[model samples]
Target: MSWFSPSRLVPSRLVPSLPPYSGPYPVGSCDVELSAADLPSPGSPPPNAPATIAFRLFYPAAGSGPSRPIRWLPSPQKAHFAAYARFLGAGSLLSTAVSLAPNVLYYTTIPARRNAPLLHPPGPAWPVLVFSHGLAGSRNAYSALLGELASHGIIVVAPEHRDGSAPMAFVRAPDGGASTSVSYQIHPHKPTAEVYAARDAQVRIRGWEIGVLYAALEKIGEGAEMRNLDPNLGVGGVEEDVLGSFVGRLDLRPGRVAWAGHSFGAATVVTVVKSAYYGGEEMGGPFIPARDAGIVRQITKSSVLALLDMWALPLTSPSAEQFFEKQLPAYEPGGAGGKAVLSVLSEAFWRWHGNLNDTKVVLAPRTAVSDDDEKVEQERRGPYIFYPEASAHLSQSDFGILFPWITGRVLKATEPERYLRLNVRAILQVLRENGTVVAGYSPLEGEEPLDGGGEGKKGGDWRILNPEGGVRGWLPVDMEVTSEDRRMSIGEETGGRNDEVRETEVLGDVKL
Candidate 1:
């Protein structure tokens, strides 16, 4: 008689002990913001000085019928034993108590929601898509997309790239060493005159934080250095060393993962793709000499379903040059080399000063306002007429989705729905062809605001990015995109640019 039982191969318990947590969900759909307090400066205060890095999880609604929720096959007893060891290390004496605890694994850490196991009868495990948010924004930004994916029977795990997010708080021991009780805190910049000063700081922080998350996931489930605190610690203060070890421990069964981001978050995704961090296409060309197994392998193994970038386009292209020239006059070199040279300064100064005002023109208002606008009976006449151009165009890309309020404020007016549709389609096409799960959310074309709505509403621009396009199922967008026909629009900033000559700022001098 076979004493061994086939049933022993699978663990009896299937449901995660943790209860589905639905804390106070923030009102409105996906959106981002920047204020004067977030601006960057040469001296003064530290970056993210008053910002918080945070995120939220959105699980798919329950599925029905035969095709049930996927389950991890032949659950590894060793992994469970290791988790038990970690629980012991954390100093809980009741071993049985810990084991018996309901919702132990899922609820033990964050009060987050998880989808029901296997939507129907037991089936194959669902593919997992991981998301990272834009700079200064939290994981919560992607809730709309994540929730949508979950509804379709996909399991999504969105980790807070803490460093990439707003400043976070952690616990430390008496000796100032990090303790396990680290709790997160949000220190938003105090509201002031400036719009967004810390944009770059948030970007840099996001880059480092994504790197940590990638490294951590890559190491999950491999007991090599299991003793280190990490994805294991109930709190969030794991050292890089510990994090690296934890990622190495992951049971990342082959051929089932993809990566994505929004706005600056999308840039992070590009970095991961460009560096081949999560396994993608080869990073070839002048800037990057070689390729890696990260994104390339991820695509090959996991089949990146889609790369959903909100209206974000590469900055190096000629279209971007035309866009800058046509939109921001102060950005024009006024014979300042090519448009690239001027745009760099424009971005930097925007990061620093948080507004559009030339020093020379400040002393001489005539130079700021064009002779044409002066002749016309316009109340405000300046080099560039702050219309809904840049923000309108930028919002079509991921930038708008990440910072909607800023986009609306900068652009001044909301645009049409067709524009939003075009961008969302572009992003969806790129990600799907690359072999990853993806979705692009945008506002409906020609959407009207309520009586009290429009530009005056706080975070109104956010509506433009996530318009009510009513959940369109995953129909992949056609790719063959190019910049030939679509010339960048020349906003009111035209004319006066020819007369002004501002010194160009070199790329090396600009901070990342």
Candidate 2:
């Protein structure tokens, strides 16, 4: 824990390495796509989907041993890049022209060692975190951010959801049969009945996948038999039991395991928390733990929540809106309170006044009368919320870092790594405050410390959730703003361009 601090973080001069993690720990990662047969889905699988779950686990490595670099894209490189080309509408099914664009970039690599040994920290147990990706995203898409978190000593699991949200994924059968290509199921972002039904179906599938992952973690903790369905897990050679190395390592205590997501994935986290923690609501209650074997008790009120640029439309979809209108699970008795929840919104998302307002409802604390005293029903301090000025929704993921040239030239994303560092700083502080033993220091904007000196010049003081614009471009959201001003401020803040139409609800989660 006494090594490489934020100030001392050295960026990988090499192009393939992701932005170097600021935390003191070295990171390792592995791919795991397991059969859902024994894990069992609580509900019917999403229409035309397989009974499988997939993800990449990034964690603090045990030793500085010789390691293999994790590819930014999984194997069958050109095919995966072609899917991205198709998803971006840059190419038709047979358009080799556009497909070649990502092909040129397919060789880029993640900054983690492949299937390296998991670090055994000098603590009771290593904390664990589960992260979900957004629309058109896979487990590899967010490796930079997740690896940053893992570099701080937590085991981070990024689930690859096959509910038609991904651009394209290869789903291998439970018995290691032929893999089937599952393409993205694009739906209208409008709040129409059909769209709601489509998204509601996705949430169910995603919730079930998360539950199954927790079950896998339980077995991995006990050194039980489990199979990783990733076709490329043993591509080079089987050096060791990477899956078995996780035995008795992860901390699964109630609230100890954190949950996070971005955009549509973030909406899934909101619904999953409600579905798993507070069943019996309008949605017929508790969908994930339908049977006793789910082992989702770890998903309690105390579990930490980190949501980034959460797309609000899915939460308001026709089916589960009623269930989630209530407070988040963190507000329950023995709950972790507002500090347990952190939402790092992007400036682009902030311009979408309506969506921003919806985000507030999801993160803000609601008041209720207690019959006699009229006391507050929720914690006075709401979730920690902020936005790094000039950032886009893609800033929180590896997209900006991976495609800095295109993003900078076209999307106008500058200093993408700085945005990611800001996110990691906030998240690490959140974990440390929650009783998880991590690095003791996360320097603020105007402060000088070890690891060298002042690296972040503006807004990293996560402790004071409401810095009221004191932290320069890192603007703390004023939850009390009026809806009228909210709409007008979108133009005011972003110079009237409203550059991002989706955050404005026009494009929605569609990257294009």
**TM-scores for all candidates?**
0.36, 0.84
Question: Which sections of candidate 2 miss by over 4 Å?
Answer: 1-17, 40-49, 91-103, 231-236, 285-288, 291-296, 368-378, 442-470, 481-500, 503-512
Worst 10-residue lDDT window for candidate 2 reads: 503-512
In order, what is each prediction's RMSD in angstroms?
Answer: 19.2, 6.6
Q: Summarize candidate 2's per-residue lDDT along 74-153 as a digit string, tens digits.
A: 77677777676666663332133334444334446777877778877678678988998888788998888898888878
Candidate 1 lDDT over 1-512, as tens digits, reads 12222234323243232122121221111111111122222122233332322223243333222221111110233343343334233333223333454233321111232222222212333345566653333343234345444443344555554442322222223233543221222223222222122333333344434443333334332332322222221213222222221222232454345555543354444443333322112322111212332223342222232233221222222322322123211122231111110011112122221112221121111223455643321222221111122223233232233334443454432432233343333333333333334332223322344223433442222232232322232122211112431222112123343212111110011111
Clash totals for all models, in order? 76, 5
| Model 2 vs. true fold: TM | 0.84
